[model samples]
Target: MALSTHVPDLAALELLLGVAQEGSLNSAARAAGVSQQAVSARIRAMEAQTGVTLVHRSPRGSRLTAEGVMIAEWAARLLEAAAEVDAGIAALRADRRARLRVSASLTIAEQLLPGWLASFRAAGRVGDAAPEIVLTAINTATVITHVTEGTADIGFTEGPQRPAGLHGRVVGHDRLAVVVAPDHPWAGRRPRNPWPVREGTILQGARAA
Candidate 1:
């Protein structure tokens, strides 16, 4: 896929996010361990690429424009996702003498894997050298497939039904609730005859909505 010319590079995006946090280019540069001039150059380059004046420079300091603030917010999210990808790659490349490869559903990988890994590390089960943890996030079917094929040591998924050839155990459960807009018909209705909500129905309704 072709990237837009307006999109700033990852390094420039990071600098923009830092400026948003520090509220000044010089301060942001200092915090990031980069020269002030380098920060300014990056910011200027980003502005040129984006075709927008991102910063308002003054004698006192620098401040982001309204658009700049919005862009910075988006940049922060992008940087966070990038960091996750970096960590996954590092884990794959780490010393593999003793490693635990895990395949997980997207929800579990995003919301639970970090905490679980941290707790496992704290328990010191792997002796002096910490066991390398490599994780990949995919759909539930793919998670099951990876485990069944012996490519992954373990798998985590959110689906209630387990596939064949796998011994399943429920570590936990998540409670789901129906949500609707205040004006929607279902907003205040407590159905006398409750029906099981299937994934296909919900997906169809969502597409229609």
Candidate 2:
């Protein structure tokens, strides 16, 4: 028989993650602000859709099956990505009374921007509430283009090179280090010389010789 194509809803996914963390249906339901019966029904419905026995229920409590653990992990990742998408959409809304427009690379958007924005709000730079911030995540080249064209008030990018026609300041720096297992041959080697080359060249060399 062909597998069902039904995808679990975000709420159900969240419930599964809660169950995994809380380790019991009653506790998961309480944390979710729902009744235990509701949690049970939702889990049953999810199992029916996926055609998998996800949870093992007994008089003691409820526990996830082996498949349930794997599915729950994936569900957690999906929910996290969904949250980022929601935040990006809120930032991109044109109707907001925005005080700042920022264009950033994916690394900055995913890793740094949220915390910085939270700090800015906490500092009360604008007021008790956060100033409206419109943000876009794009490539480094696109970030430069946006800043140069005045489409964004500020831009964040990686790499040392800066495009002309824009005043740049280094807010932070990151260094790439080669990581190897302790047992690997290169783990004990100390480089006598270091040289800079295009990233593509390094990747090609890794693949070739």
Candidate 3:
């Protein structure tokens, strides 16, 4: 069940607990690093919120009435649970930032990524606590799949067209060199115009020509 709207908030409960522990508003404010008036106001707000007179204040000091002591006990337990929740969330964030999952095409992984990661670290862009890099080398399609499926944090692949359903930008460009025998006629041709060759025949027919 949801907590009732009448329940005091965590801050107010903390202030109430402070008063209960310190035995006086002035001492509670000192322990909390707030002014005595702020602590007194917080206690009054808690009382109004819960409709219970929580603190009995006198010139001598302050004290928790019987109802106030019981409420303070419940607040202690709730605060403990809140602390555990805070710790759990912090651990998850630390784990998420501590490691990176990267998927890349095999060629890029083998030829480029090592140097890129080294440069990234040298630049200190990710701060002194760099995440551990977990690299997976696969075919380009699989790399795209990993990224689109959310199995990978990021992916690197070589192609002119962007994969569907994913955001991407070209990090770098690459080229394929057509090597030929020195004696071949095209070897010395050095044509200024781009070669007009089909994708399939670029390598095979060039070698034959």
Give candidate 1's TM-score. 0.46
Candidate 1 per-residue lDDT over residues 74-166, each given as its tens digit: 999999999999998777655443687788888778877789889888776666756878989888878877777777777887755766667
* Full-model lDDT for every candidate: 0.79, 0.78, 0.77
Q: What's each prediction's TM-score?
A: 0.46, 0.45, 0.71
lDDT comparison, 1 vs 3, better candidate? 1
lDDT of 3 at 1: 92
For model 1, which pairs clash?
A: none
**Model 3 lDDT tens row, 1-209:** 99797898888888888888888888889999999999988888888888998888677777999999999999999999999999999998787677778888888889888998888667664567568889999888888777767677788887666765677766675656677999987797776875543111000111110
Clashes of each: 0, 0, 0
Q: Which 10 successive residues of model 3 have the least lDDT summed?
A: 200-209
Q: Write the per-residue lDDT of candidate 2 for residues 53-140, one digit (tens) a residue.
A: 8899888888999999999999999999999998988876633434777888888789888998889777765546667788898888
Off by over 4 Å in 1: 95-209
Off by over 4 Å in 2: 1-4, 94-96, 99-209
Flag the better candidate by TM-score, 2 or 3: 3
Error of 3 at 87 (Å): 2.4
Deviation from native of the Cα of residue 168 in model 3, angstroms:
4.8
